[model samples]
Each structure stands twice: as C-alpha cells, then as structure tokens.
Target chain A: MIVAAMLTLAVGTYLIRLAGPLLRTRITFPPGAERLLDVSAVVLLTALVAVTALTEGGGPADAARPAGVLVAGVLAWRKAPFMAIVLAAAATTALLRLL
Target chain B: MLVCLAVGATAVSYGAISVASGLPFWFPVVMGTLVLAGSSEFLFVGIVGAGGSPVAAVLAGLLVNSRHLPYGLALPDVLGGGWRRWLGVHIMNDESVVFALTRKDPARSYWECGIGVLLCWPLGALLGAALGSAVSDPNDFGLDAMFPAVILALILPQLRDAKARRPALLGAVIALVCVPLLPVGLPLLASLGALAVVPFLDRTTVEQGQA
Candidate 1:
C-alpha cells in the first residue's frame, strides 16, 4: 500500500509537471483555488511544524524537544540562517536530554 | 555553485532523515529519482515515516507541488519540444525555474533545469542515505526535532502577513485538533481544507502580499 501510494503520487506529480508543456496555453486555474494553493503550502507546513513540536505518538512531545523547537522558533522568527537554526534547535534538545 | 551545495545538503539531509525514520533504503533513493522535487519528497517521507497513510501522503504531496502548474503557465514556451518534452518536464524544479525566468529563454531554461536536477538529486540520495545509515545515533543530534525546525525556518518568512498567516493558522489549528484523531498524514491533509475558505477570502488581500 505504501509503495502504491508513493507511485501514485509520483505519477500525479509527473503529470502536473508535464501539464506545463502540454496544456500551457489553455490552462487557467480558478483565482480562488489558486489563492488556496498559495496558502496551502504554508498551511500544511505550519501544521507539520505544530504537530511535530506539540505532539508525539498522539500525545505531547517531550519537554526538551518542544523547548528546542521554541528556541529554534525564536531564531527562525529572527531570520537566522539555515545552519544556525538547525544547530540551535538540535543543540538545545541535545543538551536538555543530557540533563 | 552555491545552489548546488544547498540542494545537495537538503537532499542528503532528506535521505538521512528518511532513513532515520525507518524508511526502507530504496524508498529515499527511488523517491529522489522519481519525485525529484525535494520539498514534496521530504513531506512524503515524513508523512510515511510517522505511519501516515500513503494515500494521504500522495495527496498532500500533489497539493504542495501543484505550484508547478503555475510555473508551466508562466513559461509555456520554456518547455522543450519532441521527446525532450517528456524528459524536460521531469527535470522542472524550483532552482531551474528561477534560473530560467531570469532570461525567459526557452533553451536556457531547459538546460538550467537539466543541470540542476542532474547535480542535486543523486548526490543527495546516495551520500545522505549512506551517512544516515552509518551514524550510530540519530537522536544524538536531536535530528528528529531538527527536521521540522529546519522546515519551519524555511517557511516562517512567508507568513509575515495576516493574509497568509490566517489561513496557515487555520490549517495548523485544524491539524493539531486532528492529531490525536487522524493518522499521521491526514491532519496535514485536513489542514489543506483551510483552502476551501479561500473562495470567500479577499483574494486581493492574499494576492497583494504575493509577488
């Protein structure tokens, strides 16, 4: 089932990519749906971040992990570089776990 | 180029992360080869790693990647002709598009896409997955937390406006509420339901913040 699902997505994504060349001129996504698409990436990603930070195995994540995420969030909010952000989050959690 | 290194880094991390999450070896490699798009590929692995339904993962991936549809429209003429068209569509990616759009030349876009894809995917998949398997401990670096943090940092700047933030907040809340109820990937998929509200959302507000 997992393999099939992956393949299904792979095919669907390929087609979407292909849609450019084949239906380029005739294509026009509805304005509202397009807006929805614009926001959905942020939406889904935020949800992933939220869930990952707050919950684990249907419950809240361990304190250290969330704390680490919090620190990372602060840096992210401040626009830290990519490496700095990842390192800060991981280091916080690692240090916390050690205590 | 700086872009190649960045792409390679993300790809390797993606491969390592997927392996750490218990994905089969072939999963990351094949996903890199087949999906080629890094963001959606990571999302797919994350969803599946967390025991999310593959069906939901596929849909969510397709949803995020639908952005490519616009890329196609933006450069209908950029795509190659004949058999190359089939291969050309496969290599279309963020970097290539960004590069292509700079000059708006068809041949240049095609070549840039090819070069970007060729350099980024395989190196990341092979080396990253190998590194992932070699590491004795993924938790040592708190890598599990690191993945989401990395992704969040990337997307954080995009939500600066209320127009974008509101929908994202809606989706985040919906997904959180569903976390205990739905399977891994479904909550994320459910978050996309926030989009249904868009027909009523002032497109100007949303579109205004956009480039």
Candidate 2:
C-alpha cells in the first residue's frame, strides 16, 4: 500500500511538472503575463519563508527564530553574501536555543 | 556536463537523506526521481510527518509545485527550436530553469537543460533517500533545514523590481496573519489568495504607464 501510494504520488506529481511545457507549444501567455509570472515567484517565496521562519513548537515561536529571520532579512537587504546571511541566522538560532 | 553532474549529485543526496530518515523509503526515492521539485517534496514529508491526511499532503504539494507552470511557459522562448525544445521543457525545474533563463546568452540546447534536470533531480533524490534511512538524527545535523534554505536562497535573489518586492511584502504579511488563523494547509491557500492581487496590480501599472 505504501509503495502504491508512493508510486501514485510520484506519477501524479511528475505529470504536473511536465504539464506546463507539454502545453507550451499550444499555449502562449498574453502580454504582461511574463511580468505576472515574475511577481508570483516573489510572492510564493515570501509565503514559504514566512511560514518556515515564524512557526515553531507547533505554533509561532515566542521569539528567536523570527528574530533570526529578521536579521537575515536585514542582511539580505544590505546585499550581504548569501552564505553569510544563512550562517548568521543559523548561528543566532543556535545561540538562542542555548539560552 | 557540469549541470548534469550537479543534478545527479542532488538526486543522490536527496535519496540518501530520505532513506536514512526511515521514511516510507520509496516515497522520497520516487518523489525525488519523478516529482523532482525540492520544495514540494519537503512539504510532502512535512505534511506526512505532521500526521496530516494524504489528501492534504497532495494538495499542499501541488500548490507549491504550481510555479513550474510558468517556468514551462517561459522556457521555449528562451531555448527555441525543434526536438531540443521538447526536452528543454521537460527539465525545467528550479535550478536548471533559472540558470537557463538568467543567462545572458544561455546558448544551451534544450537537450542540455533536459539532460541536466533528468540527471540531477533523480540522482539527488536517490542519494538523499538512501542516506536518509541510515542516519538516525537527520535534524541534529541540520540536513532537513538545508532544503528550505536552498529554496529561499534561489528565491530571494530574483525579487529585483518594485512589482516583485510589493507582492512579496503582501504575501509575507498574509502568511504571517494566516499562520495564527488557519490550519497548516489553509495558510498556503490564504497566501495564494494574497497573490491574486499581483496580476491586477501589474495590469494597472501597464495602463497607468500608457496614460
């Protein structure tokens, strides 16, 4: 049953990933469509990040991770190196966990 | 090619991790092989681990994976041509798609991107799944968190305009508010609702510019 479920999910997911390009020849997005597509990435990514950063211990964390995320965000805004921001956030989280 | 090697490494790593973690072994292996999208796969594991229903997991995974649609649509224009075109479209996952699109001249045939994704995605997943089963404490080493960080890394670099920035802020606010209000899956839905404003905003911008 588990294998079956895995296979079913795998096939279904693959089909969706393939669906866009499969129809690309048959479909052309209208003008400004590309711009909308571009914007969607930002929105989707922000949503993902916020969800990950804010939630902890089965709910929103009281503090720490959110603070770490904010610190990372500030570094990101300042155009810091990607590794630096991530390391800083992780280090901060580890420190907070220690306290 | 370098891209192909990267894709292979990614798949192998993914497979190893999944296997080491003692998940339904085939789940991550197949998901890494076929689903080939890391964010959705992470969501899949997360939902399952949280004891959510399969329906909820599937829905959440699909919602996250929907971004690939735009990627597919945008690719042919960049790749251009016959057989290579179809292959290019097939391989349009996060990394390859972005790399192909962002290149000044890209100059890669569709087959190159297709081959790269085909190689990297499955191999990475396989590696991770295989390794996952062997490792007792995956989280202790921070491997689980690496996926999200990778995703965020890919995403943050692309918010280069006001149009992009505004919707990101809106989506973050919506997600933050919804986090307390909705169940796990529903927050994602709410975020999508927030994203609906993006198209309207873009249209209004174009009209104002013309006026």
Candidate 3:
C-alpha cells in the first residue's frame, strides 16, 4: 500500500509538473501577472525556509535551532559555498547537542 | 549542462540528508522519483515522521506546489503547440523553466527541458536511496546540520527584486510567529496565509510592474 501510494503520488506530481509545458501554448498570464509570478519562487522558498528553520518539536525552538539558522543565514549572505553553510550549521548543532 | 548538474547535486544532497536522518532508503528515493519537488517532499516526510496525518501531508505538499499552476499558465507560448508540447510543459518545474527561458541560443528546445527534468527526477531518487543504504552513520559527515542550510542556500538566489523581496520577508515573519503557535501542518497553512497576503499588500507594486 505504501509503495502504491508513493507511486501514485510520484505520477501525480509528474503530471502536475508537466502541466506547465503542456499548457504553455494554450494559456497565458497577463503581462502584469507574469511579473508577479516571477517573484513567486522567492516568496515560496522563503516561507519554506522560515518554517523549517524556526519550527521544531511541534513549536518553535527557543534558541539553538534559530542560532544554527542564523549562522546559516550569515553564510548565505556572505555567498559562501553551499557546502560551507550546511557544514557550519550541522557542526554547530552537533556541538550544541554534545554540550 | 548546468541543469543536469543542479538536478544531480540536489539528488545527492537529498540522499545524504535522508540517510543521515535515518529515513528508510526507499522513502526519499520514492519521494525524489514521485514528488519531483524537493521542498515539498522534504516537508511531506518530515510531517509524516512527526505524526501528522497523511491527508495533512498531501495538502501541505499540494499547497507548496501551488506555484506551479501559474508556471503552467505562463509556459504554453514558449513551448509552442501540439500534444508533445503539452506533455513537455506539464513536466516543467522551476529549474527546467528557468533554463528554457534563459537559454541564449534561440534554437534551444523545450524537448531538452523536458528531457532534463524527467531524466534527473528518477536518477536523483535512485542515487539518494542507494547512498542512504550504503552510509551507516550519515551524521558522521554532519549531513543533518548541513541539509536544511543547504536547502535554504538554494532558496536564496531566487529572491531577485523588491516586489518579491517584500513578500518573502513578510512570509518569513509570519512563518516565524506561526512556528510557535501552530502544529506541523498548520504552519504550512500559515505560510499559505502569508502568501495570500502578497496580492493584497503588493497591489501597487504588482500594478506598477504589470504596467
């Protein structure tokens, strides 16, 4: 059942994804809407990150996770390599876990 | 080539995170293969693991994925016409669309875009699953700490201009406040709530840009 669910979900997602190219010709956003759509990615992604970084254990973490996220934010602002931001945060978490 | 690299990199990263977090190897593999959207899949797994209902998981996944609807509406012209063109557009995601739209070569084809996304989807899932199975201690490499940060890093480059930036900041603030107040699935709802405000708050900006 799990496998079936997974497969169904996968196909549905693929279909959803495919909708863009398939309908590319049949539909069009107005010029103004197109501009708004362009920024949608940023809004969507930021909300995602915020939810992940801030919330934990069914509620917001008091400090440690946010601290880790802040470190990551700084690395991100510095435009450090992707690996570095990840490493810095993970290392901080592991260290905090130990202490 | 860059598209291929991005897909490949994402697959590897996901694989590492899943394995480190002790997720079933098959889960992330299936997620990558089926969901195709990275953030949504991650949210689904995290929610399910945290004991959220499957229905909630599905709704959250769909909400995060709602952005694709507009992308669908916008892409038809670029893909041209026909059944094949339709199939191509249906599979288009952020990476493929950006690649297709920005290709300097006028001759660049939607076929290439379709093929790239389709091919990468499974390969990434398989790779992540395989790697997850192989790594006994995924945390030794510090992947758990790195994964969300890496995901966030990938997300940042998309915030291009002031109009987008304002809503993004608003959404982030809402998410932060909601984090303390909501359950697993409700935060996603709150995020959507944040997004719902984008049109209302930025009507002037949207109007100005559209004009």
User: How do these models rank on TM-score, best leading?
Assistant: 2, 3, 1
iRMSD per prediction, in order: 5.0, 3.8, 4.0
In order, the TM-score of chain B in each prediction is 0.62, 0.61, 0.58
- Candidate 3 lDDT over A21-86, as tens digits, reads 455445565775665555554554566667666665556554555566678878887888766676
In model 1, pairs of residues that clash are: none
Task: For model 1, state the Cα shift of residue A85 in Å.
Answer: 1.8
Off by over 4 Å in 3: A19-25, A61-64, B1-31, B39-67, B70-142, B145-147, B154-160, B178-211
Candidate 3, RMSD to the unseen true structure: 5.7
Tens digits of per-residue lDDT for model 2, B101-150: 44455546444656666766766676666566464443333333333343
DockQ score for candidate 3: 0.40
Tens digits of per-residue lDDT for model 1, A1-99: 877887888899899887755664465668755555556656766777888787886787888888888888899899877678877888998888888
What digit string (tens of lDDT, one per residue) describes model 1 on residues B1-211?
4345556656677778888888876788887878777767878888888998888788878876775665555443555567777777887765565455433474675576557766677677777788986755556657667756765666677677777778878988998999899755567768877767656567665576695
Candidate 1 ranges beyond 4 A from true positions: A1-9, A12-30, A57-59, B1-27, B36-124, B128-133, B196-211
Q: Rank the candidates by DockQ, best first.
A: 1, 3, 2
> Which model is ahead, 1 or 3, in terms of DockQ?
1
All candidates: TM-score:
0.62, 0.69, 0.63
For candidate 1, the per-residue lDDT at B22 reads 89
The sequence of per-residue lDDT tens digits that candidate 2 reaches over residues A26-78 is 76667666555555545656677777677752377546666666666777667
